[model samples]
Target: MDELKGEWFETWFDTSYYHILYQNRDFTEAERFINNLLGYLDLPKNVNCLDLACGKGRHSVFINKKGFQVTGVDLSSNSIKEAKPFENETLSFDTHDMREVYKENTFDVVFNLFTSFGYFDDYDDNLKVLNSVNKMLVSEGLVVIDFMNADYTLDHLVEKEVKTLDGIDFNITKSYDGKHIFKNIDFTDQGKEFHFQEKVQAIKKEEFETLLEKTGFEIQNIYGDFSLAPFNKKESDRLIIIAKKK
Candidate 1:
């Protein structure tokens, strides 16, 4: 896998509507997803957490407000720079490529929310991030990977849609290439338009489980949504997994 090919993530997520989508009025729903995943882990309030690919500090801030110490990392310098103003004693953000392992056994919980895992252009490059994450977890530490239900996403695929957030209109289109899901976004505000493309690997559940197992993590729980309902192939909006280091 070519490492440099995945650099598009930095541009697509940094200065685009990506921030608006998660930080706008939908914040309540985002908070609910974070809290629900946290509840399933049942870790101590003071546990240290690593928010991988943390965008605009959404989930990171929520975790901090819940009394956990959080360190967020993202490839986007712009997002981290914006996140700096929102940090406190318990919350901090840094700009780093997730493929590189920095701290070992440093976090009791490593949270990768909102399908942030599959952004890499290649499957193996994506697995590098998971390998690094596996090394970051403490013994018996918890890992909560929140992603869209791929089967459902494919079954009820929405090829194109228009949505409004923070008074801006967004035209979104999706393309699934068997292994990758590409989203083309056009944002319009006050007659100004901006466009960007984001590609996330459309990795299936079995494939993800294989990645986890190859990286030496044991899959413990799999849920279809934030509510923690059991995963069903035909029904579910989200695919949330709780795994432990083996």
Candidate 2:
């Protein structure tokens, strides 16, 4: 397949080193959240779902195991390639852009989890993703979005740190403008120096409310953390939204 055409996410997320850097991401916590969410959703046994920007399929694999037909798509071919080994009759992975619809009226649920959004510099592209997802869902289908609480994240931002993973010391610095968060990564590997950047919009809850409303979705529930508590803009670790297509 042709490589997914995009910007920084297209390049940075595809690198092997990216996986290495975040290798310790907590699958257990993710699974626990999934369990809580699925239990709350009580979706049918045979419902079809999509995992948008599903890098390497950790959550996709587990979601499929819970008896849903799951299709995982990511902008990175390398991530799709890594995720393909777990594919089966009911679970599949593909390389696709999130701003485009994969299939019209195809899925009963769509999951954009783990802060997999806010990559685009163009705000319209953000609308494109939600609009395409709106088109892709069946009537009243659910879309679950797990995103960072911009205020809380900024408040707790670590300005600088170095993490040594697999004998490579990754020097990292994080900064936030009034609009976006920037993480600068500098490191040396095999005597070659490298620098890569990650940028994400610090979209607030009110902005999301506007986005969902404009895109024909009804906000069903909003949670603060993985445990599914009520959202508090000041104290929450994550902004978990469950919206239903109108």
Candidate 3:
């Protein structure tokens, strides 16, 4: 699809251009973040992990390498296809929606990393995701949510930018309209123009605290960045939350 036709997330994320635009990803940072999280959790050997919205199984592969049985699930079938070759006896990939329980009370941990939350238009759908995670996790199992700090992101928002990757130039614009952050991407590839819009709810820390507590999860820690640093509203880059099912 050269133009935005279906849902923003599904259509855009499944496109080849999306992968090409983000090919030179910061893999080092992602690895470091996963390393810090796994070390801090200090989970038991061979514990089960469900990597929700695990695009291309990056985190799932890393976790499986750490001796855990990891199952990665994403909404994009293309991403799952890309990740299937990495699977082994203890690692697998599938296409799944985060708003539904993939398996009830089966995983010792659930990971919703890389700002995967807050895409739906309905606020209650976010609650549905949390609820689904609650059902998917066993009692006392942990859930890690790595989301962007909405306030900090809005404060330092880039209105416009052009990123050239793999000989393709992507023109992007971002803005926050009171309740949601909107990102409009425009680019031309192979002489055809494409446009995609990404919208995510600008839910804040207080909001997540309420949602998690309401969904039977007790917040154990709130870090502002992947370094496990204390949260600072004005300066931190990410809002990483670790919670346990009550």
Candidate 4:
């Protein structure tokens, strides 16, 4: 239960406030993306799937509803506990680290969605995640990584904002230092002020391609957005990469 391990994500993501801050994420849009991906992949019914970094099993639930067996894994024990209610014969959730391979050559598809990456300070740590993904896949299995388009994000950076949600005033500031984007979030809850920092490495498309190549995956396709549009470096909101095991 040592949530504060020096990593910003290790502390921030375990709090209830994190969920409150992101509660407005578009579920319909995510569902559309998942459906589009499922159609595009045309994976076999019986093949197992892994929802890597699946927070609270939303995507896992959707995929399982599509009749695919899924195992959702996340680093947050609280997330796993909340997700366990959705488990059944074909759906399960476990607390796990993405840098370690949970089951070798077991899943037909692995999904790392919603910018649930780039948290590690060291680039090699990110590479370790890719290696783990590669090891967890069957031969020719597919992996989809959904990440923010760094180029576009840098171009459209919002420096500061103040918002009130549920009577809590959140003051947020953002900055990017070439290699990483940092967000400083300040808020007051129950008369006590609190501050949290979130840092994500600003990994680019070329860097990801290099990592995937090094990890023994063949690049299958790259989409620009949740709608499966072709990737345009400066225009896309998301960088969705689909790769197959070599």
lDDT (tens digit, per residue) of candidate 4 on 136-233? 99999999999999999999999999877777887999999989999988988987788888999889999999999999999999999998999999
Residue 175's lDDT in candidate 4: 100
TM for every model, in the order presented, reads 0.89, 0.97, 0.98, 0.97
Task: For candidate 3, write residues 84-198 as lDDT tens digits.
Answer: 9999999999999899989999999999998999999999999899999999999899999999999899999999999998888999999888988999889888888888889
Judged by lDDT relative to the true structure, which candidate is superior, 2 or 3?
2
Q: What is the lDDT of residue 51 in candidate 4?
A: 99
Report the poorest 10 consecutive residues by lDDT, candidate 4.
Answer: 1-10
Better of 1 and 4 by TM-score: 4
Q: Model 2, range 1-246, lDDT digits (tens) per residue? A: 123345779888988778889989899999999999999999889899999999999999999999999999999999999999999999999999999999999999999999999999998888999999999999999999999999899999999999999999989999998888999888888877887889999999999999999999999999999999999999999999999999
- Scanning candidate 3 in windows of ten residues, the lowest lDDT window is 1-10
- Clashing residue pairs found in predicted model 4: none
- Ten contiguous residues minimizing lDDT sum, candidate 2: 1-10
Candidate 1 vs. true structure, TM-score: 0.89
The Cα error of candidate 1 at residue 236, in Å, is: 0.8
Model 2 scores a TM of: 0.97
Model 1 clash pairs are none
